[model samples]
Structures are given as structure tokens and as C-alpha cells.
Target: MSRQQLAKLDQLSTGQTLKFNYRQNGVPREGFLVRLKDTWVAYENRCRHIAISLDSDNGEFFTQDGKYLFCQTHGAVYEPDTGLCVHGPCKGANLFSIPLEIGESGVWIDME
Candidate 1:
């Protein structure tokens, strides 16, 4: 399987996020990785309510309180660890989760 590095595990602190691009089946896709308090999470940037980015290019994924993921365009709130949309238009839906592999070198996502 092919993989791409997203961020250095040492560099990403708790509550920080990094955005990266990758290709799946030759189609470019956007993804974001967040270093949550106790673990790491990654997801496709697209909001379930609409095929738009969760953040309005501002790179802000968490709510001001840092308790949940916030979609600027759709107001969809997602539970960071589970990707479950607990509130807003996409309620009952989930964010597309990208399995992440955290290693000493960095955070990686399988590209295959």
C-alpha cells in the first residue's frame, strides 16, 4: 500500500490540525489531521451536509471551545474522535474518516 506523510508527530501538539492533499484512484482529495487530547484523528475535509469543506479555508476545524469539530458552511458539529455528526444539518451522518498511522517519523495516511 502507498502512503503519504501528513505531519510530524512531534510537531503536532494537542488540539492542533494539519491539512494535506493526496490522490485516491488518481483523484486528488483533501484531508485534515487533528491531534486531539488523547489521540489522533483524520478525515476528509468535506462536510456530510454538503460536498464543501468543513472549514472555510480558515484551517479552523474545532469549535472555539475545542470540544467538537465545526463546519463553517453547514454548521454541522462532529464528534472529533468518532466523526459522528451529533448536531446540525448532517445530524445522524458521519464525517469520512481516514485511517491514520502515527509513527515516530510523522502522521501518515494510506493512499492506496
Candidate 2:
């Protein structure tokens, strides 16, 4: 696997997300990294139900309570760490997780 840095650890506060853009075979894609409790989690930013972006252009991915990732378009809720859709239309599905590695310097994605 090849590693690419996404963001520095200090760049995100707990419960906040950092959106990242990447190219796959020259096609553009978006991903996001979030700090959850003691670990960081990454997802493809696409909603499981409609395959649309979970957040708007403003990067609003969390619900009002800030405990779950919210899809404003379809009202789907996901577990931040596990990416499991615990509520809404996509209850049985999960967000596509991106393999990530965290180091002292930054958060990195395994591009394979």
C-alpha cells in the first residue's frame, strides 16, 4: 500500500472532520477524516443510501448533538468510528471506510 498524508493531527479537534480530495485513475473523489475519542476514522464521504456526499459544501457532517455523522439529504445517521448506519434508510448499510494510518506527523491514507 502507498501512504499519502491527509492532515496533521493537530488540525482537527475531537468531533470535527477534515475533507480531502484525491484522484483515482485521474477521477476525482472525496474523503474525510475525523477524530473520534482516541482514534481517527476515515470514510469515502458518500452516503450509503443515495451515493451522494454526506455533507454539504460547508462540511457539515455531524448532527446537532454532535454524536453521529448525519446525512442532511436523506436523514441517515452513522456511527463516527464504525461508519455503521444506525438509523434512517441506510440502516443496514455502512459508509465506505478508507484505510488510514496515524502517525506523530499526520494522518495518512493507504492508497492501494
Report the Cα RMSD per candidate.
1.1, 1.6
lDDT of 2 by residue, 17-101 (tens): 8899865555678998898879999998899999889996779899999999989898999999899999999897889888887
Query: Which candidate has the top score in lDDT?
Result: 1
For model 1, residues 18-82, the per-residue Cα lDDT tens digits are 89887777789998999987789999999999899999999999999999998998689999999
Q: What's the TM-score of each model vs. the native?
A: 0.94, 0.91
